[model samples]
Target: MKYLYGLLALYLASWLFTLPADALQQGFFFWRGQLVQLSGALLIALLAALLLMATRPRWLEQRLGGLDHLYLLHKWCGIGAAGLVVLHWLLSKSPRWLIQWGWLTPGARHAHQGASWRGLGMELGELAFYGMLLLVIISLVQALPYGRFRLIHKLGAVLGLMAGLHSLILLSDPLRNTPFGWLTQLACLLVLVAALWSLLGRIGRARRVTGQLEVVSHPAPDLVELAIRLPRAFTRDYQPGQFALLTLDAREGAHPFTILRQDPDTGLTHFAIKGLGDHTRQLVQGCRAGQRVWAEGPYGRFVLPDEGATPQLWIAGGIGITPFFAWLEALARQGQTRCHTRLIYCVERPEEVLHGERLRQLARKSGVALEIHTRQQQGLLDPRPLFTDPQAQCWFCGPQGLGECLASALPAGRLHHERFAFR
Candidate 1:
């Protein structure tokens, strides 16, 4: 949230620096024009930020907290951009409406100029706006299949290209002479470049590694565990609590899943996928041993505390337990545990708990206090009882509602939760 605030502040500052003082002193007619300009600039800036987020830059992930946080920021930017585009469109066309309503006579302050290349630019901008609106709406719709959503979402790149051209063609002369103008031009260029890069399927290409599905296991009714063996030449380094984008099928696109565990000796990366979406259901139904998969990550910053002696409270809900599984595996391999860790595993039903025996075994061997909570028996998790230690760092991976409730109850900055839902 701080990152978003800082971005908004920077945008406002840049806009103010570029806007002429006389524009504010001018009549309502000029004021409306200035408003339109401001809205357009903001819309382009938001689009530029969205484009950069699509690339999943590590630096941004780190700065913004994590990849999940970056996605949240991306979502907000898209919404904001859409709003600004709508405002700009309405303001630009309001003059004609005013004239038609007889609120202003011909050649009056609200009079609209004749159409030209500028009008064509406005038309293209409108088309791009509609495209973006549709994409954003589809992204918000959870019922839509992820593969279809992904394919349709790429149209954003086309919209970005169109928007860049529109901005370049319709920018006012006063703004063109200012520093903001050059910044705008650079932003447009970057947007176009990002769109091209995404359309070319170059995002995260360098980090991608090819692997074959060596094993598949069904630990629960809706869960499928996959073990992907990487090529012998590939040497990958990842923390226990990180995730990777797995591309099982080119048409379905890459979907992010937490790395359950990785065998160092065999170089087999494991993923425990729950059948929650179309992609996961497809993977469960269609994926087989010996199938090829492209993994393009090891991304995220949800690793354990580096130097903390305080007791750690690890809370997981349902499938959110995947990362904790990896952490326990790492702890087991290390042969020693530093801090006192407590794991509260929660699920709607006992049958939904994956690797219950493995978790119990690891907890005993690593000196972790484990508590399993099933809603059917124990009811909702009572987080209030766990806040005894003020110094304890609470790590949560679960439903957003659960995270929010725990976060609000715990001390500020003590509750840490990972963002799982990309959209």
Candidate 2:
């Protein structure tokens, strides 16, 4: 559905750029064909963006579904709208005619539509257009991997404000006199306001849910699994496969970490993090209890029970076993504990299997058929035989290359995957 909506918005934007020039040229008071098309496109794009922001489809919550799909659509709609507006300016003779009337300055001779200072309005409009273009590009594809994208994404708000100002100053005449044009411009202004409000609202809500990270024990060398205890109002039973975004300070950016354990009885959420990335390295070194850490979401759809009724084959590679640990814990909570589960755990060295005893206990308790493959000693585990079993449902969480191997080896419907890529 999101893919369809993105295509529709793109199509509308293109159609708007090609609207007839004579209609707007004849009478600015009348509803020109170009104005009508542009207005429709603007409204559709705005509404679609709003819907994507607010709607979280139920089916998407439990599986690797349409969450990313909707976000991509929202992003593209913003880009397409900016591009169409640029074309709209080029097609209209307002640029040239304004220059002839001394509206532009000599410095604007090349870029401006008109020849004089009165044409300075064109300069402002062009400035806003370029600003919007820059913001759209950065948000759509340039900035990525959160840490790298943070500063630029923040600057997007400034670009948006510039765009709103330009529209208000230069396009006011056509907008005020024509009902459709006025409504479209008004809607754009409202979108800008709504976006700002939603951002602030999310930030405030995220701040309020901040908690303290308490170190239970340093089980592994240079590795500390912190049990972050959230406030009563914020602590809810999270699913075994979801993760939370954590930030030590409200001003700092968030980093996602999987919820390793969920104690329904105690209401404690655990995060097992190794010293990796700028954030985790700092976290593993010194982050302590009684210090506030903001947390947002129980995001991601990477679990077993939610994937429908099917016999399971759980594959874990190194620390990718985070979700598997939670799944095992969830099984214990349910108390229907015969582990008829299959686990193919692949690690580099023997010492890398940190939770071996617990896994053995889980296998014994729940009837899980356990298989431990050490690549350093025994080479890579063969996944072909696992998929040979017709009843098996393969789930993988690790490297994309490894997932691709499993995806190609298994039947399409039988395989479920959750890839942990930074970007």
lDDT of 1 by residue, 287-377 (tens): 7999889988778888766546788899999999998888888889999674488899999999999889998998888888898999999
* Predicted structure 2, TM vs. truth: 0.71
Per residue, candidate 2 scores C-alpha lDDT tens digits across 121-162 of: 456556656766676676667445556576555554544544
Candidate 2: RMSD to truth: 6.7
**TM-score against truth, every candidate:** 0.92, 0.71
Task: List the pairs of residues colliding in candidate 1.
Answer: none
- Backbone clash total for model 2 is 15
RMSD of each: 2.7, 6.7
Question: Which portions of model 1 miss their true places by more than 4 Å?
Answer: 1-4, 18-24, 106-116, 232-235
Among the numbered candidates, top lDDT falls to: 1
